[model samples]
Target: MRVLSIIVLLLTTGLTSCWPTSVSFNDTGSLHACLKHFQMDPLENSAPNAPINYPIELTEAIKSGIQNNTRLLLSGENTKPQVTITGKITNYVVSPIALQEGDNAAQNRLTVSATMDIYFDCPNDNYTHEMKVVSTRFADYNSSQDISSIESQLLSEINTQIVQDVINQILSNW
Candidate 1:
């Protein structure tokens, strides 16, 4: 009985001492911070297509995109901006290349393309400004990978980059 009790104590000690050795994310957390900084509350997930408008509509979009992401939901929260920027992801590009992978796998080169509309609404200024910024990035993923999963991941990663870039732009121009 004493040996059994000792074994139980040791087992419990080991179990309680265990923890996740690591936490990982590609860009979700940073993206979330950007969203929260912009003061977006995410709506339930559905088709990416949501109603859009000239300026304020873009605002909702920036909010929606950030809100939908798990990382952004945690980090990207701030009071709604007096002047905000928003845009839609109109075009996405996926092309093949002969780039070498770490394991020398024949895979396609990943690239992301999107058009962004930036909003500048300042009550102090007499003019409300809207501008478009186009952004792109190359995502390195195994070429010999599943199309759907790679595409989804590439888009998410680039979207996070885009959101970060756009937020930086807004901050600078302000």
Candidate 2:
């Protein structure tokens, strides 16, 4: 009985004294802080049917969206790991969707397609991801309604969708 008690005590001591040295902490936690130091390059407009020569709509939207997204903190200029986002608007289309009584267009759809590459200057092995994002908007128009205003509104809607897509892509990479 004394030998049996000594064996039990020895077994418990041996089990408790061994600390696993194989476990290691993840270093990816710093990546989130690094994401705050972001920089956006001007988006290139390469669409053949693009009405404007510059991509102000697309560029401004993405910058604003990233700055406003809660998951990220925008750092104007910092020494941390830098995040660079570059992209181009590959497609832009405005087409009539609905016809009026006289065969005139009553409603139209606007679509914008873009591709973006996100690069992180961090130590992580996976630091870059290419994302293709698209947005579409529909508007009802007639002779009385202002065409420019409608177009602007449609563009705004498309920008909103694009921003959401960009945010989703970045979050999913994590």
Candidate 3:
């Protein structure tokens, strides 16, 4: 019995040793190590059909998402940042989807697109890079519902998707 107990103890110790000592929960992947400061410029709304408030809402959402997912800090107005993101709403359109009997629409799809230009400055590595990413996402609502009644919810979903896309673009550089 003593031998068995010793074997079990050794096995437990061996297993524990193989386990990772530290786990990182950061979603920024390798970016947390290099880029520490970020700045977001006010987005321009070039989409003629988009609501006036869309640029503000999307800017805030992207900022919040980055802060929550990465270790990067927002640069102060007076400070130079290691990263800068600027973008414009390029497209916003609503169209019929899933046509039914007599060509009536069963659902309507709201699509939003944005063009982002991200600049990275890593003084430590003497590296500077710029990338342009265009992210487009959509949400659907029942044709019976008026778009005005559901626009906010649809925009919220699209914004989340756009945020993820932007993050992915940033992380993929490394």
Candidate 4:
């Protein structure tokens, strides 16, 4: 019995010592720590005759999204050259997606597209890349549901999707 107990204790110690191996992936924090600063510029409204004129709120949402993201740290006070992201809301269109009767629209889809320029300031060199992101949401013309409420929800979703895309683009390099 003493021999068995000793063997079990040795085996348990060996197993525990070999557990929890250090595993590191490409998304480690140390890898991203160098490019920590993320400066967001004012989002430009380039859409001529846009359906909605909520540029301030839209811009604020994008800024908040980038600041709140875990991958990148917001650099509002830094005056040095950092990662600057400039965006332009190019299109906001609501079109008929389906028809119920003759010339009657049953479903409508709202699509929002934005252009982003990601400028990276490295120690050796600086470069910029352009990425276009889009998001779409649909609404059904039902009498039971309020049209304005449906549109408001769709718009909110569109903004979120676009912001998520921007974050993905920023993180894709790492």
Order of quality (TM-score): 3, 4, 2, 1
Q: Rate the local accuracy (lDDT) of all candidates.
A: 0.51, 0.68, 0.91, 0.66
Best by TM-score: 3
Question: TM-score of each candidate?
Answer: 0.46, 0.64, 0.86, 0.70
Task: Give candidate 1 misplaced runs (Cα > 4 Å).
Answer: 1-81, 84-86, 99-105, 124-127
Q: Sorted by lDDT, highest first, which candidate order results? A: 3, 2, 4, 1
Predicted candidate 1 versus true structure: per-residue lDDT over 1-174, tens digit per residue = 999999999999898789677777665432222233333333222223322321243345456654554233322344445334434445344566665756455656555445666554445545465656666665766666876676656656665676666555544444
Per-residue lDDT tens digits for candidate 2, residues 1-174, read 999999999999999789675775633432454455677788888888776843787788887897776345455544453577888888877777677887877766666778888776655544553444444333344544665667777677778878888877766664
Winner by lDDT between candidate 4 and candidate 2: 2
Query: Which candidate number maximizes lDDT?
Result: 3
Mind sharing the TM-score for model 1? 0.46
TM-score of predicted structure 2: 0.64
What does candidate 4 score in Cα RMSD to the true structure? Answer: 4.5
